[model samples]
Target: RAPEEPLHLVLPSDRRLLRIAHAVLEHPDDVRTLEEWADWAGLSPRTVTRLFRYETGSSFAQWRQQARLARALERLASGEAVASVADALGYASVSAFVAMFRRSFGLSPGRYFDTQAVIA
Candidate 1:
């Protein structure tokens, strides 16, 4: 088995945070739990949260929200309806998603996408 292939290891906390951040970006709409990310990182959820927050200055949930909105922006900019984007991002209702989005971006998703369209 070629010496069983040495286990990949990363020790620097920043490197670990970057890996977790990338995972959030790639799986933005998945609503991954902290336990899921902890398992993937081979660390406890508390450790992941601490290091991620220290390195990124945000909790995993907060960072994940940013990631989801980034993806949502792209989808909306591509002309997908807010309803479909909300559903795809694991939101139970368009209104709920819009409320969260407005909290983050100061405008509703429809208006955000309209701005993008105008800018383009």
Candidate 2:
């Protein structure tokens, strides 16, 4: 994913899904379950699940993970410390954040930014 990508770039047209998407984007660190989110949005859990897949072409969990990653990339690019970024993103530890970063981008955060610098 591009580091410059905006969080609200493509929102679901459905108001209920839009509400949840906005909430997730605004609070990527929020670890709420789908049922809880659905209740908050005044939606049925099953409806939210199906609508997320239909509208976003991904599951709610996947969408939230991507949002978190986007936020991570933005924060890291702004020169935030790795540990600080991990904590802000609600990772259990810096290592866990690094692991997820590796899985997503095939490089550690430091290396990833170093590479972007070179590419730029």
**Candidate that would win on lDDT:** 2
Error of 2 at 80 (Å): 0.3
lDDT of each: 0.73, 0.86
- Measured with C-alpha atoms, the lDDT of residue 112 in candidate 1 is 66
Off by over 4 Å in 2: 1-9
Question: Could you tell me the lDDT of residue 108 within candidate 1?
Answer: 93
Model 1 residue 33 lDDT score: 87
CA shift at 89, candidate 2, in angstroms? 1.3
lDDT of 2 by residue, 1-120 (tens): 655423443567799999899988888878889999999999999999999888887888878888888899889999999999999888889999999888878899999889889988
Residue-pair clashes, model 1: 0
- Runs with alpha carbons beyond 4 Å of true place in candidate 1: 1-15, 115-120
What tens digits encode model 1's per-residue C-alpha lDDT throughout 1-120? 222212122223576667777766666666668988788878899998888777666677776776777778778878898999998888888999999888877779877657656867
How many Å off is the CA of 63 in candidate 2? 0.5
